[model samples]
Target chain A: MRGCADVRALLGDEAVYEAAAAEAFPEYNKAHLVSLELPDRSGDIIITTYGELDKNNYLDPRTAQVATVNHIKQNCTELRPAADEELPSAYIEEFRSALDVELSKYVGEAYPKGVCAVYCTSGKDIEGPGANFGFAAVISAARRSPQNFCNGSWRSIWTLEFSDESQFVEIKGKIQVGAHYFEEGNVQLDTNIDYKYSTILQSAEDCAVSVTNIIRHHESEYLSSLEESYLNLSDATFKDLRRKLPVTRTLFAWHNTLALSLTRDLAKELAIGK
Target chain B: MEAAMDLVRRMPPGSTETALNALLSLLPDHSIDLLSQVDLPLQVCMDKESLKEYILCEYNRDADSYRSPWSNKYEPPLEDGTVPSEDMRNLEIEANEVFSVYRDQYYEGGISSVYIWEDEDKGFIACFLIKKDGQGKRGYMQIGSWDAIHVIQVGPEEEGAAHYCLNSTVMLSLTTDNKQSGTFNLSGSIRRQMSMTLAVADGHLVNMGKMIEEMEGKLRNSLDQVYFGKTKEMVCTLRPPPEVLNMRLPDR
Candidate 1:
């Protein structure tokens, strides 16, 4: 779908988001856009992914599902893409400026290094020639709000090619955490280390998979739980592509905040990137 | 037919005693000795005093001789010269799980008991710590038979972090079950500290870690309730559940 306008109407002048869906497009609304008003950082963020991506897109869902389970909630926001240089420059600048305010959360000296930015195009139709960030920085940047990809945060372009609506699902990178990183919160570790796809999953792949996996985990109840429980996760097999560190303990609390935020009011409230 | 039904109702793990009677009524081919071998926990047979106790308590001695000795025999010498013989018998058991030797023995002078030995490997992967009554009825008690003493070494999967606690003391207890009802306490010490580096090359150890912690021998109330959807149904696994009977250890 193209040019849907539900989120902006919902925000009602509140700078949290701008959304668009198939209601604006001719066909059914199979696509969505979400942009966030990062009130505390440098620039804003826009996340978008197809509504029908499968769960197999992610490398590992079981060991990694707990990465942000409790923090999830029911979030269904309508996101609108930014018009190109054709649109008003001031409003777009305002959105980007809000993100700069959010960036302050992780701007300290010890902030992670090797950040990368990766995004995908379903139709390969991204028309903007913006300064592209590296994958490491891209992922590092998204850390403040990974769920944006699933909610209303969509960027400026929808790569439409031969009837295919294109989009960048995720941006990639690692935070270079230390040896003493124990995720002992209701939910922690915003992302996962073990990925399963054979294709080198760009950050685009990670975002698509993460969003799709969440939708799938919540779609039906315990139908897939057995498959999740007994799969052959023999080792941290993806460790070769990863760095190693001695972790004392990590408790991934589920049935709590992570799932709540991701499942419920994330897209509507506390809309980080969207 | 009357005799066959009586045999069915006599005891738990007692189908062996009814074998001849059940077979007599059926065609020769209808009854087959599917039994291929007799193994033991350590090849030790029931002690003499316990054998007397079995007969006196109306335990069918005819079936006693046919069961696996190590699993059937219950005797640990309390006297000065008996430990070595017991050790020798146990040593042979470790060699192969196909055969067992049972004997009769008295432990606390007045306490007579049946000693049963199964495969030294998987069947009893976790050493069950059993606590018997200073005075009670006799049999190779299964679930509902006796309280269980949990031990660390009882499960088959003790390797990494678990082996360090010298968790050599896995204690279990017998909950509710389908036989003579009274919990017995079973307990034991690992001959060694244990090794987490156990190389489970292939078959029988895919879930080696889990088997070390819990195996197929014992059953729980949950399995039946979960599997059969009944609150207290005993039809779990078509066999008696492994009850956690003896749980005195504070560590468990």
Candidate 2:
């Protein structure tokens, strides 16, 4: 291999200083760093770099220099084989049992409003370092509409894609969360709860009188936005907002009930327990 | 005119198959009641081209309010809209002319496949023809097929409701026709067929055989009252020559 000093002298400083592919191999070129014994490393740090021009084109050399210094500072001190081997059956069982042990703690919690459970299946098809640890979790909460404690049910579900990666193991995965307050056959108030359907008897006729006034406060901006298609966001966000509308109405009803209950309790307290 | 162009542009490009289907089922089911209300002595006539225009016009008029099960978007109401766009206005005129031409051609050259018989004593008499005309010629392969069927029915009187049984079978096929002349010229065709039996009594589906049995006696009684005692000469309207009449009848 030619000496760095000799090559640099041959090519002027400007050409030699080009950190990218040096304009010679513009189409394809790659570089890798294998650190045997750097300033603060007991082991080795190896990184394969492909493509020209570092993705982050921060013009400030100071920031780039700082990152380089930090990387050098964090380089591994001890040499170790990459622990990316296929996870064995025993280890998989151990991981699942551990999750079960953690979930069992919430067994006695109140869940009449709603309950969520998630399951994971692993076999020969998907088996690798990142794929070895794969599982999901779902949580559901149900709150009764405060109007009569039974006027409606507000349910929400949160699903999480969880991956276990302890130590330095490259993990690639996704986590998704969804919340739904209504299911089939449930009381479906008009998109705007103002116009009630003749087919369905209102669970609480009084509930509507109160909710109608509350929804009026929100109808102007929300309804007009719904009438037009120029919403600032994506179709998905629009659908999500539509789903949340009823949930908001139910929550408001619950809030009213809670406030009324608090006022009644306070009056009793003021009466000296009479 | 501008509004009409916008509407047209908004519609997804449709294939010839879809256009043919729309032409076939052009009449909306809800219009049947309105058609029945037309006076008994009324004589309705339509040509293929005219029928197509009438169907399209009806569709455009009702599209805004009707919530079609096949469409996802709810079309906005256009009650107060005016003919503001010159393009759309021109298109409107052109469409009218096109429809009129088609209608005229159909009236002039199209076959009169319609039949209607009315009796004041009965509630209603309705007859219509459903036909598919197809013909195409290629150098190596030629194809020609025409399928036609006519249905005639009498409705129940207002005073009395009776059960009606209808048993029918249809064979449906989805076929494609392809033609290639040289290295570059190529085309394809499509066909769909469906057949079913439907029985209705008092506006609801019922067992076909049972309803048929119940109506058989009532029909025989009516025939006896109308034609049982009539002489053959009085009842028969057409008479073939003696030679043709003397021919032997085929075995049942």
Candidate 3:
């Protein structure tokens, strides 16, 4: 029966505890202030929520759990507010399934086959702020050609992190398209193209659309360009086989070279006879 | 010619082995390995008549009737006929003659064949084939090309005009082997489709001829540009040319 309001109340209590700890441990507070100024530690400060909270020493496991659930619910619309009995990882799964539903709309229409999955890590493994958690959505599709003995696949991964400090979600995306064609004793062709992107979104409403648009742009622009290049490479390879040398060039002096080598053999034979 | 002459001039007056080594330096490492192992004074000969027969046999294998080089099996004749009409057979013979001349002009010496057939009440289908084989002192090569064109009639689009669909496919295969070097083989096919509407009173053969000619030219250009040209560029990117092997002894 613990609703989102209860989670908010828990977060407020944690904030009060954090303020009390800062006053009690002024030395620890001063060290944190000094560490924040160091440039090398700036990146770690953005991703290591656990390190910051551990130094404060005020967040118990229950408060940490409530803070994570509250942060995710506030940032992502893909999942409902977590229930009291539900784990934080369960919310990640719910978010993943919601995104999967949106992505599956492209399957069989834009792609022949597809698979979407989500992966997450919490506590010490968390690399970014807000609830000490991060998750990645992996979306992939493939188009196959049994006739040509060839297949092509495209994959896009979106790693998302919510930051309480910035009040925004950081989305790092990578897309790759690859194809392979092989026929025994004939030809083998393989080609691939890939790109990476980093985006900051104020809300999760447009996340699914953004991912699909990225896929569409990649397929229409980069993937088609890759296919064109592959066709050219295939053609050139065949042409090289057909004519090793330019037609204008006379044949290599194989006959003359053979004659000279034969004369050398004959001379050696005659010398042995002598 | 100038490059080879320059290479020969750079060779010192030593054993044939030294001269061969010098020559081998200009080639890629794989080719050099093959050439070095070859017995000198190699000789190869290919009989034109036998080659022609072999090509014909290969083309007709597994066929019940007159099989075109581009097709695996002979197409059934339109209407109640066991064989193609005399006019169509005669056209095939004429095509063979024309393609032979083309082979002689471009390929030096090779074999050529053509087949034409009526497609029910629609239009016609024609297939043209050319094959060339060569045997050099240390290597051999075989190259063949097949073009098939199908013209189908769609009802007239307007008064006194007929609409037709022309579909064509061009296939190529090449195999080359050097006795001392490695072997290379490649085969591929490409297709094109077109629609045309011409006056019904116009000679069907003339319209078909023009269509075939244009289609062939466009397809060939596409193959050259999209395939061969792109592939060559990519190959260069994949493996940049190696630096020439320096055969000269460095000055101390």
User: TM-scores of all models?
Assistant: 0.18, 0.17, 0.31
| DockQ score of each predicted structure, in the order shown | 0.01, 0.00, 0.02
Off by over 4 Å in 2: A1-90, A104-110, A123-131, A139-274, B1-252
State the weakest 10-residue window (summed lDDT) of model 1 chain A: A178-187
Query: Per-residue lDDT of B132-203 in model 1, one digit per residue for the tens?
Result: 232222222232222222222322334431221122221121222111221221111111133343333322
When sorted by TM-score, best at the front, the candidate numbers are 3, 1, 2
lDDT values, one for every candidate: 0.23, 0.25, 0.41
Q: Residue B198 CA error for candidate 3 (Å)? A: 4.0
A68-105 per-residue lDDT for model 1 (tens digits): 01001112222233233222133222322232223322
For residues A9-92, could you state the per-residue lDDT of candidate 2 as single tens digits?
333354543542244222211121222222233222222121012321101110111112122222323322212232224444
Q: For model 2, how big is the CA root-mean-square deviation?
A: 34.3
The regions of model 1 sitting more than 4 angstroms off are: A1-274, B1-20, B30-46, B49-197, B200-213, B216-218, B221-252
lDDT of 3 at B227: 46
Q: Just chain B of model 3: what TM-score? A: 0.47
Candidate 3 Cα outliers beyond 4 Å, as residue runs:
A1-274, B1-81, B102-108, B133-164, B175-186, B199-206, B236-252
Which model scores highest in TM-score?
3
lDDT of 3 by residue, B62-124 (tens): 333334432322333223324446766765554444444433433445455555667665455
